[model samples]
Target chain A: MWLRLNLRHRIYAILTALVIITISGGLVMVWYTYRMERLFSGIIGRDLVGFQVAAALEASLVHQKGFVSYYYLDGDPEWLRRLGEYRQIFKERLREAEILSDTPRQQEILESIRSEYNEYIQIKDRVIDYYKTGQRKALADVHPQLRELFFHIVDQCEVYKHIFTDQIQEARAEAHDQAEQLRYVAGAAILLELLLALFLAFVLVSHILGPVRRLTLAAEGGEGPGRIDNEITALSRSVRGLIQDAGQVHLELERSREHLLQSEKMALVGKLAAGTAHSIRNPLTSVKMRLFSLGRSLVLSDTQKEDFEVISQEIRHIDTIVQNFLEFSRPPKLQFQEISPSTVVDMALQLLSHRLDAYDATVTLQRSNPLPTISGDPEQLKEVLVNLIVNACEAMGRGGAIVIREETAVLPRVGKAAVIHLSDNGPGMSEAVAAKAVQPFFTTKDEGTGLGLSIALRILEEHEGTLNIQSAEGEGATFTIALPVKGADT
Target chain B: MKTGFDILITDHNPHVRRFIAREMTAAGYRVQEAECGADVLFQVSGNKAVDLLILDPDLPDIDSAVLLQRLRKRTPALPVVIHAFSSDMEDHPEYLKSDRFVEKRGASIEHLKEVIQDLLIRR
Candidate 1:
């Protein structure tokens, strides 16, 4: 029944039981005290008083005997006076005993004593009269009857005393019995109180403290039992840690969501660019053909020719823009083959040799050994290298030395990879520009298509590789391309 | 009537076809224009001996793969130069099985003229 109640109800029940027990014990104490008071008062007020009166009656009666005897021996009138005073005292004591008597038996005993005492008093007076009138023989005849009446009155007084004594004893025994009953009640109350205290302790330990201990253990991941003294404090600290972890996870989710949004925007731009470029290509080709034909067949002055040539160059530039857009929009399918990146680097350098000479740039290839073979498209890899080298050449304008370093190294997250570090002695981009360097259509050059780095990044991403650019303003830029090695952890 | 290798230029755009036909005619080759896959098929199956075919392979009616397959089955010996965006055919290598793959660009005509000349001279 106790277990069925919740913690709150159980506590209330225990406390209420304790209160009732305490109140009952207090009431029992009060009732026992009141009963004891009544018992003691009965013994002191009625029984004891009656017994005292009975004793006084016996004492006064004995005093009367001695006084009469003394008067007979000495023939003194003072003895007769003392005997009379004692007789009055005996009568007053007997009357007081009669007034104090509550039972019929006690009253009957008092009535017998009163009648016998009155007869004795008359006989004693006659004996005194005979003694005063010179009648010794008459006095001698009544003296024995007076003595017997005195003995009888004293015996009745003893009976009355015995009655009061018995009543006083009975009241004492009743008080004692009540006290014994109260003692038993007190013992039972104490035992009940002890049981209640034990039950309350059990409820506290099992229902309250037990759950708290378990919560503390769970909060602490059950590590080092009893290590923390305060379970509440430990639980609060654990909750705080959990909140912090959740906050960190929320922040990471926010960052990833932003990244996903950016990727989605890029995809939309790619689709738009592809559609626009495809439509523009056909018209653009016709214009170029017409321009070429006009340039070949028409006669013109040097200025007109320059104007014509400039128009052609601008048109070609537009075509290049369109081409870049198309390529950016339409990611080419990668043709994967087992090939060394070193070979691709050599091919790009060879292909861009004339362009490098035109830009007054120097090319340097550094490799300890042929880098490990990777599954990649050689043509696409060469295009990425060409774009990077061209970007460096343009950034430097002249006298830029491009170093292409190839090596096999273990990269974090990408494991074993063929690392290519293409560093250039050129005025590097600022932090802001470098950060946006690989984004589409972000460029610093006047004639740049701005899709070179982005396309290269995309191509490298397709190959499960990464392109990282490290640069500071006024310092040269190093573009690192890491391609995971074939049959290596990626 | 010109006395030279008969070359057929196929493109969806009439302007592009006219441009290529003019350029090829100026280059001293007999030129024919076919703006769709059906025209190219009709011309190739006809009595007019087409020495070479310059195909953009972006016909509206027929899929490029099926068009190329039909063209190949008809004229196995005739040279077919695929003229389309490089990105368009980058994923479909089957389109590159033609005699030539010319990326359509601003300077594509010059390259196309060279390919046509080479193919006709070889034929």
Candidate 2:
């Protein structure tokens, strides 16, 4: 399901799953910590209760008559021997109680028990001295206070035992409550974690993967990259870029194929034109020769002479059209030479001087200090200049300035060649027209064959030059011809 | 200029052949015409005095290079001029190891006359 999702959704789902795992892991840790704390508290409470009970029992034993008798007869031979044996038993029991006390509360109770036992021992020693001195009244007078002290200590022992029992009961209840609370909390955490995990899984599979699934369907449906949107826009962008690149490549291939087909068609046309021209040239030549000979031989009427002149002019026009067709279709072999571009421009301007004068268009040359020499057929370069100048003149119609600028600058280095830019400024073409200007037979003028620019472009390509056009609707057009400057080795 | 030599023009088109013939006649030279290589060979074999041959590079029957070699074998001294219409001539310059190459499109009648006159004078 996640694989079916788009890239963006897939990333989001992965993050969500990670978050869920992290949160669930944290909850489990909390639950474990809570359980361990509860167990520790219960053990401490049990130790405290056991220490309190042992301390109370030791206090009661110290206040009993057996304890008093054992301490008072310490000087008598038999009684002293019995008292020593009882003291040993009492010390053993006190050590056992101290060993049982593990918690801080248990240790405090054992300390109190040790201090009270020491106080009882001091009282027993005083009573034994009195008995040894034979002080009968004194022993009787101290007898009441000793009995009262003993009874008071016994009451304290009973109170201590009761408090220990109460504490033990409270601790047991707290432990039970903690256990129940732990079970509830652990169960709740597990349930919540499971629900959260399920929710996260559902979110990943539904919202995130849902759109991705749709995208996959769309892609498989052949709807292409444009159909994707929203969070998956990056994927859409990349897909769109790929699709656009492919489309452009396909379009370029189609254009190339069309160009090849057109060239084939033009080749056929050229062959036919050549044959037709050959056939027509003979008859036309004979007619012209015969007409010239007839004119030399006869004195014709004005009307007949006018008719002959018209016929001759018409034939000449047809001849010119046919010649243009042949020249345009079958260009002459290129004899490439390293020639100065300025010289070619000069020649072109000289040839078009009359037309420039008619249009009142000025030709300006802003040349580089030392123009690089380019290798090209001189005649073909002249033709390109002628065509461009003529086009500029036609565009200006009434009158406009034509600037022919030459600049020598290195293009971004591609391999080992530099590019020279020759730009022209004239009444510019619209984007739509400029795009189609290089196409054969795509004419903007009524009398134009539209072959001039096409032929110029072909000639430039033959010279390994690229022609680029930049123009707006109103702000004139600049045609920049970039020719790869020959390197030193070439 | 005594009609010093007889020339054979071999081309597929009758109009081209006639044009060449007329041009040669105007230059005061004897001219013969053949529409194909076989006709040229037949005419030459049948006792026609053929001194020079002006041929189209593309012939229907025989390859132009092969025809040139065969003609060279037959008449070692005969000067041949190849009139090529296609730019494919650049690929096969060996075939054009002839006396001269006259491009048909740009070469005027005067130019053809000059080449022939030069050849005759040189001979």
Candidate 3:
């Protein structure tokens, strides 16, 4: 869930958590230290007060004994004054013990110490007064009682000191245990802070830094050192899609460029053909005239006559090829008319009838009836038909049946149209040859001008029609001419 | 048509010139062949008194149009026929003053013979 947060929010959240953990750890340490300090201070303070009261009471008892000795031995007035000061110190020490006692047992012990000191002080005073009257026997008997009272007070002070010492020991042990616990807590707090810092670093690396690095690599086309994640994967897929789209556009551009080059080639061929035909025509005409004159002037045997006839025939064939080239260079301007496609087809067939028969090829004109009149140049249409039929015949060198069919069909990029199919049962062409078949000046036959289909395709294109062919190796070829119908869009 | 009138033929192709010379010579006209523009000028300035000039526009040595203009200045009344290839046979207005033009194509030789016979008969 935290990983889904955006980078900024994730960083901010981790920082906040780290801060809170640090502050809470510090607070826990402070609270533990304060509680331990208060408990240790309470225990040790009561014991120190008890020890002070015991020491003061012991000093007071020793001073009282010394003062009584001085007064009995010298009977000096200064000794009496010092005796009073000792008496006052003893009373103050007892008062301190009374105030220091809190528990009922200690309070009761302190009350006994107070009463014993009071009785000893009163007996010492009566003995001092008898001494002043010169009765030493009274002094001697009371002194023993005073000395016993001082011994009892001494025992009480020793008992309170022992209690204070034991309590102080207990306080020291308790404070030591608490100090050990606080040290452990402070150590745990530091460890917890370290863990928090480490966790934030992990989040920054995995959630923020790692993903950002991956994103950078994805942007730079996966060339960097980063692993793939979903966003990067998706970005790469789209980039690939864009590249593929550009590739397709480049392919289309290359195809269009090829077409432009082919057209340019055709234009060059036109210029070349025009120049070449005229150059060759002059000598050809001269040769024909000379041959005519020679033939008229001389008589020849039957064999020589036959040879002359062959030469004349070959010369005529050359002339025809030259004429064909001239025609290719200058196609006739189209004269559009509504003409029956069947008429043009039949006309071409009749013209090639002899050649067809010589090849022993049978042509089946399916539905030899009148097709719907299409708007096109009849003479040009006839020429297109003648060229295609002649090509079909040439393809079927030995003999093969050709099927000619006509019908209304829908063509791609054009509407409903009239389609003519001229199929030959001869050896078909490979896909490569079939593709370049309509390109001008592309020829397979040694004697081919390669202009037949090229001119036909140009003429058909002038009428906004298309010539398409389909063939596979070893099978026959099918040449299809699709012309838009009368009312159909070109 | 004419027994022995002087005529000049100018062309770069020697074979074409030979053929035309032979045909015109057989027809009884005194025929002379020049292979270039300089040859035309050389033959025309001589005492041959050329009656007609048949020229092909493609010349080896100097521009043919310039030679034709110079030839016209030298022999203004000499009937001139341009026997040119079809592609170069542009009927420019400046060249229309030539007596005739015969495009080298089908029936061009026959037409040239007729033009020559007519020009000779008129001469």
Candidate 4:
């Protein structure tokens, strides 16, 4: 079930677990350290208090005796033994205090205790001396001084006890404060980790899961545009581009297949044309010879002569049509040269001027200023223009103006190519026809071989040029040709 | 109009060989026909005074362009006419270059006759 969750949720869960473990471990360590510190502080406080009480009791005994000979003069072994026991206990307490002292302040306080303790011992020795020598006058004279010295020793012991107790209390307070801080920090850390985990989960859901879901929905052909998240936006864009490129590739492949099919069809036509022309030409040659011979032998009537002339003319027209068909079916061997587009257009216009005049149609020429020359077959380009112009003239029929314009505009946004648009106001083709205009042997004309546009398209393709067609039913058609401008060879 | 030179036409297709022979004969020139590259080579090597060699690029026994090269080596001055199936002769001019290039389809008989006559006269 956990593995089934998304990555974001999983990450959040893992981090939350880590934070809880870390905070709990830290709190546990702090609690343990506090307990140990309190324990040591209690032992130090008890030892210092015991030492102070023992010092006070010994001082009171010395003060009541007026001198150190009170116990020795009375010969009280019990007091002496009690004092020895207290001294031994004090020595043990001092050793324990030294063990507890970790700082310089605590060490200084211990050193003071040692020095005051030694001074008390020296006073006790003096009292013992007075008792041993039987010096009553000396004991009476030093009585007040001894009392003062004992009180001073008691004061020092009290001060040492007070200092240790204060230290123990301060350490306990600090440990309590630290433990409280750790608790607060752990609580805050756990809370923040929870919030962060929740935030991360939300982000993952929206940025990753949301986009993926939308993509799936889109793939399923759901309605409306898919909603994409920020994290997937880049990937989506790239995928969109890849899809577009694939579409273009598919289109190009389709076009190439169509071209191959057209070429195959043209090859078949060429074979047929070759055979038909071969058979027809011999018979036609014989017919022409026979007609010539018959015309010379007979003094024929004017009508007969005129009939023969018409027959010959009709034969010539048939021959021309067959020849054109053969040429259209056959592929052309291109002669490439650097030629200006204007020159090709002008040549085409010149060839078609008479037809245009007969139709009462005027031809207009609009050329790019200082048109750049392109590397292509000039004769082929002219043939393409001638075909287009002648077709336009035929469409206009009685009379219509044909607008021939050329421009060298940079189409960098589309691709690095120079574009030329040729628009005409002649009768435009239907969408269906326009789509298949470049297909071989597909023509609307009664006598059309239907290879003109196909050949032109092939030539343009050979020159690495694109032929774009735009047409409406009555608004006329525009043909835009885009070719890459040549740069210096590397 | 008859010319002394005899033109030999070699092609895998019988129709193309016959067409070329007929056109050449019509133009008043003697004609010989070879169905394959081997037959062409055999005829040329057997002391047949062949003035022009009209061959298709793809033949049965040998590659037409290579045969042309071999023929050129044998008879350097023989004007060869290449009849290509496709229009992309310009792309492979180095290999397909002959005295004249004639497309198998849509070529005028007059054009072929005129070119052959020019070559013979020049020779």
Candidate 5:
């Protein structure tokens, strides 16, 4: 249950417990010391004074004993006067002892001592009177009795002194017992404090420091030693890194989702377009045949002939569009053959020679060396080349010069590849158009099917190749084609 | 005025078949029409000497690949002209195994006539 608390709460609980123990233990020690101080004051200020007064009373009683005897012997009335003075002193000391008395037992003993001393004094005074009256027999008998009273009073005073002494002894003993109790309590508090300290250390080490060390290691990917002094600092750095990585992953996932949605939409459109194109093919073919037969059979004026030719040309254009849709929707099976890329290039130029002448475009093939042989569909490659050339020609409109450069290079991730760079000396495309040039159905031309570059890219991808378009407004466009060499492991 | 060569024209569309048959008949060859795979097979199995077979790959009754395979097995020496869209021919290159491929287009009749003349002369 203790382990379930988080680092902050765990430290808080331990610190709180430690503080409570320390404060309560300190308070108990303080209270014990105060009690001890009060006990010592009581013993010194009251008990010790009471004991001293009791002794003084005993001394005065003894002094009067000898003074009364001296009066009996010398007959000097000055001795009698000194005896009265000692009596006064003894009475004053008894009063002081009574006032100092604290417990009921000590007060009672003092009262008994006062009564006995009074009795003793009265008997002694009687003896003095007998002496003064010159009654020798009576004086001797009373003197003996007086001597016994004096001894009894002195014994009572001794008992009163013992009472105060006993109180002092009791106070000392009580203080000792309290000090012993305080010792035990202090020892227990110290032991408890030690245990709490150890527990706090244990919690900090195992629960906090251990995990933080491990977290720092994991966050650093076990790459480096502890460079940061503070563990939390390193952890925060790692957390920042992880957060950044998570953000990038989220962005990538969003992009992929959008791309998937776009591909699915294109796939759906392709399916619909293919179906429509296939259905239209048969009827379109019948119309073509009828037109063919009509033109061949009928005799017509030049205007009629021109109209007929225009209609036929429009029908052919529609057919071409339908064919493009079908081709885009259903990719043809590639016929891979071992051939040099230069061969395909030559074929494309030969095929497009008449179109080039019509468009007034000149092509210069930079055949430094025949391109490396690769396994690909030559017909599809030729088609792509022809399409690019035709587009370049149309862009230039007239007097366009196209340069075809071919080479072999080792491309990263594609290994050895046959690279073809077809650059046209014509007005290039804007960045936006260039970026979307390979997208299906994205076209700048009015009469374009817009599947040319898309189909070219698709065909290149099937051959494990790439098509890259580099163009800027007012600058000529450069189309780079890279086809991986056969048997080259990337 | 019919020539010695007998031609079989197969297509799912009746109008296309009718026109091609008309064109071929006018060109002095005896032409027969088959609208479906079954009809084409039935006509080919008949005793009539079909010197040539111009077949559209897309038919109603059977899979084109299977029909082409069957036709190749039934008449190994017969020259079959695949008269279909170029896109269709590209999709199924096995159709290229036929004697000739003539894309059905506006000016395709001249190409088709030339192919037929070449095939009959070779036969």
Candidate 6:
């Protein structure tokens, strides 16, 4: 379920869980704290107050006894005043004790304490009166009873004191028990919250950060193979695909950059050729005319006529070079037509059969009975094929087999196209020569015009095709011309 | 046919102009030379006896097409021939007005002479 949800929904659900846990935990803590505070105040305030009141009543009763004893022994009037003061204090204490009683047994204990305390106060007064009238014997006889009454008051007060002390102890024990229970509940709640938070953190880190880290690793080209996590592996795969796409785009850009530079270089060559042709062609015309005039006017030996013929021939050669230069600089318009690619190849092969026989070279062709028809200029395409075949034949001066094949091929970005493969088992070209083979005026052969491949390349370009050469030293050379299949683009 | 009728040959190159003039002289026609368009206009308007004009389209002083247009207005009845650097000139009105268009190096001097004789015979 978590995997099915996208990142946004998962985050929302997790955060909501965290919020609820936090709020409920806070409420539990607050409620527990309030209960604990009330328990704490009850234990300290009420229990301690009961203990203090019982202690005060015991001290007052003891003081009254001491005052009566002093008056019997020394008969001082100050003892009488002290005894009255203690008696007033004992009454005040008894009144406070009565008000503090809550339970029925505690109320009964307070009533017995009130009665015993009043009897003690009455016995102390009788002793005080006997002391004041100078009845020493009577006071002596009352002193023992006063002593018994004081002890009785002490006993009841001790009972009342025990009750307050017992209450204080019980309240403390109960408060401790409640506090212990609250500690367990609060501790459990806190532990649950902590566990929940840790779980949430684990989920958040593993789900969110793990995939992101894997994605980063993939982007950095550092992802290891055989990833286990489904989500992270998928993210890594996507990143890898993106990288591959970027790499393909980069390769295409590099190809276009090289193509553009080649075009610019060709443009420069055209301008230079045009200027040079213009300057030299006019002079060549004059030379031809002058040579003809000399031939017509001079009466000379065979040697002189031969020399004039040689001169005319050399002049014609220069004229041919100039004409070829102009032609390269300014290409003739293509006469486009729809023709069978194989038919054109066959026509060029048939034209070259006589030449192949002369070179003692054998030729072979793939049986393409009815190849797809493509739009092209048959004459120009034939010229391109013938040039390539002648080049192959020349490379194999010692004689070799020439093979031509055709197929439907698919190119990168550009779709299906027609391909003609012409392979020659001859002396293969070096990498340097292969690199610059199609550049104008670059030739390796002694008598080559150096414009054949360049011209062929130009013609193929007009048909939106390319000449691809593959060669290595001591191996064979293969030239593949890839032309677009159907909708022709000039 | 007249034996020594005068003809004008105009070209920037001295060799081509002189060569053609020599070829026409051998054919028994009086040949005059002009180096520039102004010279052709000057010689044509000055000499009423000039029988023909052979013009090269590339000239030093003036555009050959402009010169031809101006010269045609001045000498309407004179037969004109264009010696071109390229063969395809069916598109130009000025060139089509000429009685003959021969590509300079494309045609032999013998072919140019044959054209000259044919045009003079017609005249």
Best model number under TM-score: 5
- Give a tens-digit lDDT track for model 3, residues A88-179: 88788778878878889788778887778778777877877887887888777777777788788889878877888888888778878877
Estimate, for each residue in A347-459, the C-alpha lDDT of model 6 and write its tens digit.
99889889999888988888656456778899999999998998898899857899998887788634577889999999898999998899999989765557788889999
Fnat of candidate 4 is 0.00
Q: Give candidate 4 regions above 4 Å deviation.
A: A1-338, A358-360, A412-419, A462-464, A484-490, B1-33, B47-59, B73-123
Q: Candidate 3, residues B1-123: lDDT per residue as tens digits?
A: 457788898878787788778877887788899998888898888986788888886786887667777877988877888887644544354554455887654345568888888887876
DockQ of each: 0.58, 0.06, 0.19, 0.06, 0.74, 0.32
Model 1, residue A6: what's the lDDT?
88
Which CAPRI level is candidate 4? incorrect
Superior candidate under TM-score, 2 versus 6: 6
Residue ranges of candidate 6 with Cα displaced over 4 Å: A1-236, A297-310, A346-367, A397-414, A474-476, A487-490, B38-49, B60-78, B87-99
Model 5 chain A: weakest 10-residue lDDT segment is A222-231
> How do the residues A56-151 of candidate 4 rate in per-residue lDDT, one tens digit apiece?
544443443432344655776566666666677667766766765566865776677677667767766666667677777877777677667667
DockQ winner between candidates 2 and 5: 5
Encode model 1's per-residue lDDT on A156-233: one tens digit a residue.
Answer: 889888998999889888888888888898999999999999999999888877877787778678664667787677
lDDT value for model 6 = 0.80
Q: lDDT by residue for model 6 over B22-123, one digit each (tens)?
A: 778878889899998888889988936598888876788887667778877988998888876762343475565655876787346777777877887877
> Which residue segments of model 3 deviate by more than 4 Å?
A1-237, A257-289, A315-382, A394-420, A424-447, A454-466, A472-475, A482-490, B1-7, B37-53, B61-84, B90-111, B118-123
Of 1 and 2, the candidate ranking higher by TM-score: 1
List where candidate 2 sits over 4 angstroms from the true fold: A1-340, A347-362, A372-379, A390-401, A408-436, A444-448, A462-464, A468-478, A484-490, B19-30, B62-66, B81-118
C-alpha lDDT (0 to 100) for residue A230 of candidate 3: 56
Residue A346 displacement (Å), model 1: 5.1
Backbone clashes in model 5, listed as residue pairs: none
Candidate 2 lDDT tens digits, A2-114: 56888667657656765776687578768767876775576465646564656646553663466445545564456655565666666666676567656576566556656
TM-score of every candidate: 0.74, 0.50, 0.53, 0.46, 0.85, 0.64
Tell me the tens digit of each residue's lDDT in model 5 across A1-490: 8767787898899899989989998899889879988998988888788778888989988888787668778989899889889989998998888777777887887888788777877777777777788888988778777777778778878888888788899998998898898889889888988998998999888988879878888989988575658888888888899999999999999998997897787788789879989899889989988898898889999999999989988888888888888888987688899999999999999999899999888888888889889999999999999999999998988899999999988988578999999999889999999989988888999889888998898889889899999999888999999999987665
Model 6 lDDT at residue B9: 92
Location of the lowest summed lDDT over 10 successive residues in candidate 2 chain A = A413-422
Per candidate, native contacts kept equal 0.60, 0.00, 0.12, 0.00, 0.80, 0.40
